[model samples]
Target chain A: MIQVIAFYLFATLTIAAGALTILARNPVHSVLWLIVAFFNAAGLMVLAGAEFIAMLLVIVYVGAVAVLFLFVVMMLDIDFAELRAGFVKNFPLGLLLAIVLVCELVLGIGAERAGGIQLGTPDGTAATAAGASNIEAIGALLYSKYLFLFEAAGIILLVAMIGAIVLTHRQRGGVRGQNISRQVARRPEDATVNMQPEVGKGVQL
Target chain B: MTEFFQTIGMTYEWAWFVATICGILLIALPLMLAVAMIIYVDRKIWAAMALRRGPNVVGPFGLLQSFADGLKVFLQETIIPSAANKGLFLIAPIITFTVALLAWAVIPFNSGAILADINVGLLYVLAISSLGVYGTVIAGWASNSKYPFFSAMRASAQMISYEVSIGFILICVVLWAGSFNMGEIVEAQKSHVWIINGFVANPLLFPMWVMFLISGMAETQRAPFDLTEAESELVAGYQTEYSSMSFALYWLGEYANVLLMCALNATLFFGGYLPPLDIPVLYLVPGWLWLFAKIFFFFFVFSWVKATVPRYRYDQLMRLGWKVFLPVSLGFVVVVSGYLMYTGHFA
Candidate 1:
């Protein structure tokens, strides 16, 4: 009974927040709503007994990604009228995309209801082992069964990160950069001089 | 606890609900009191380091200083800036204070005495800590002010930068413990290095502990890493525009986060709740007391650093997080994991 209540609560909030993400006028509010959507989805994951995935969802999406989104959106000097102007011009494309998405959702649900494939249930071998926790079960499957795919995914992310860094990084000839090691390594001897001079006599360079 | 409630004639679900509520109160109420006292303790420690008396007048040795401040804030007007985003401005401080308290759920206060003994306990901590950035970010943006906005931007970037290294550092600990469960991680530390009761005693892990300590400080936005609230430039940073109870919330929440970081340092590196030496006679002292001692020790360290070390410049702070800590921590992760594999520890 509690599970039913929690599922509905999470599901309702998720949909509401997702809707608000698009409907909100302010871009910052939109991002905040998107975070709310992510959070509720994570709650749903937790209710499904995939606590590890749920926590990862919160950590990666709501924690890191949405924060960047918020950061960018907050700094944007937005023209509300200009934004709304584009909405009318882009309506047909948006409507077409929405229709395609709706069709895909309907077809996917229809296929699931028609028993197109025998996806395993919760009580099957896919369920966590009798004594093992969620993380251990996932780890066993991920490391043993899907290790190559996981490593490939990690490599892909690394490549993307490096590509971004390389594309954005720049060197300017005139820019002075602090070498922290050199700064730390400097002693009174290397960067300084002690001299005694008579009156009206300047120290030599 | 639920079972005890069940014996009181409640249904299992009701018993569980009641037990959970009781558990939350048990942790949160004391946590509030502890935060209050910890503020005073932090000030005293900082004061002693500076060779000055701190908060001596409010109560005996200024014990009631935090409470007096709390009452003062409670009675003061909550001034909302005319230009500020009203709803979000109000919500930000609450978010800060609540998120600070939220991570304590997974913290094992003693053996068999955790609020939420979930499997992914450490992940939960990481997740909650990550949400902490939102408070500052939201407060910064919502205030629609220059200084607070800049502070918020610094905070978001600083937190995200440090979190990357922090995540890798935690992976090393998780690898060593072989479990994400906080209780199991604590248990794994017992007799970790011969008679030593901590992972810190291991030569391999000692560096990780140091990095984790520094990252933890940065993550909490304590002195030396507190670029977000650097008063010289950004005038209290994100809290510049805040006033009254809203301001007080940030103050309390900041100290609470410091305490939480202290707790994490104790739990992850120092043997959490275990006696420093694994002697039977030491077990006579309660586990919670030991945890408290470790927490206070770490808190003192935090206070000492705050009082002594000068603040890091913004670029230097970023340099430390990215250039220095990031690569080292990431390399340590690989080294630690390889060592574990080579030693057949996993096998």
Candidate 2:
């Protein structure tokens, strides 16, 4: 009974938050609303007994991705009036896309009703062992059956990260970067030259 | 608990609810008291280190000092900036305070005495700790002030930077332990199945512990990694615009997080509620006392570090988290997992 209540609550909240994410005037509030949607969706996942996925959703999307959104949205000096100016111009195209997407979703649901799709359910061999926890179950499949695919996914992420770093990195001639090794290696004897004739002259530049 | 409640002429669901609320009060009340006492202790130790008297007049050797400070802060009027986002400004500290306490639900206080003995306890801790940054970030942004905004930006970046290294370090420990369950992790330390108990039993894990310690410090935003609240730089960082109980909440939450890190240090590496050695005689003493002793020891170590180390420069801090700790922790994760695989530990 509690589970049913929780499911409905999360489902309602998730939908409401999703609507708010688009309807909110401020981009910052929109991003925050998106985070709320993600959180409620995670709650839904938890209710579905996918604890690992639920935690991952919270950790990855709400924790990291939404924080990035908040960071960017907070820093931006965007004019909301100017943003809304394009709404009517793009409304027809957006409406068409939305209708097509909704049709596809309806078709997908109809197809699913006709012939149910076992989404995210692991294969027989890699199925969760009896009494094993959710994490262990996922790991057993991920590490063994889908190892190569997982590795490929990791490599793709690595390449993307490298690309981002390389694209953002800049080398400026006048910019001074610290050389900690040389800094630590410096001794009073080497950096400070002591001479009796130093009194006659100020110091070496 | 539900059965107990049912036996007592209550409905099962209500019994569960009552049990949960009771459990919360059980942990929270003691935790609040610990915070109070620890604050006094922190002041005393820092004062002694700096050759100062600290607070001696409040109570017997400043026993009531924290309570006095809390009362004083509570009495002060909450000062919200005229231009501030009032709702978010109010919500930020509450978020921080709540998130800090929420992580404690999964922490194994003494054996199976945790509130929620879930499978992915460590993940829950990580998720909740990550949310802690949001409070500071929200507070900073909502203040509608320059220093606070800069503080929030610094805080978010610093937290994310260190979380990477911290994640890798946790992976190393998790790989060694072979489980993410807090109780199981502690049980692994008892040295039952493996050649030795605990990851620290192997010399390779020593460096990982060191890295975990440093990363834990950085993770909690304590000194010298407390760039978020660097008074000399950003003027109390995110809390610059906060006053009264809101500021108090941040203070309490920050300390609670520091204490949680200390507790994690004990639970993950130092055998948690277990005795230092696996001797039979030491089992006579209560486990909670052992846990308490370990927590206090780690807390002292935290205070000691704060007194000794100077705050890191902003660039230097970033360099350490990304260039140094990240690679080192990542390398250790690989090494630990590989070693485990080679030894047929997993198989």
Give the best candidate by DockQ: 1
Write the residue-wise lDDT of candidate 1 on A48-152 in tens digits. 778998999999999999998998899899999999899999999999999999999999889877878554353533356779888888889899999999999
Candidate 2 ranges beyond 4 A from true positions: A119-129, A193-205, B192-197
TM-score of chain A of 2: 0.84
Tens-digit per-residue lDDT, A1-205, candidate 2? 6767888999999999999999988787788889889989988877766778888998899889999989999999998687888887899999999999999999998976665765444422323467898898888899999999999999999999999999999889987889988999999988886656555686545
- Chain A TM-score of model 1 comes to 0.88
Task: For residues B95-151, write the lDDT of model 2, one tens digit per residue.
Answer: 999988998898787778888887888888888888888999999999999999999
Q: Which stretches of candidate 1 lie over 4 Å from their true place?
A: A116-126
Local accuracy by lDDT, each model: 0.92, 0.87
Query: On a 0 to 100 scale, what is the lDDT of residue B39 in model 2?
Result: 91
Interface DockQ of each model? 0.87, 0.71
What TM-score does candidate 1 reach? Answer: 0.97
Residue A20: error of model 2 in Å? 1.7
What does the lDDT read for residue B265 in candidate 2? 86
How well does each candidate reproduce the native contacts, as fnat? 0.89, 0.63
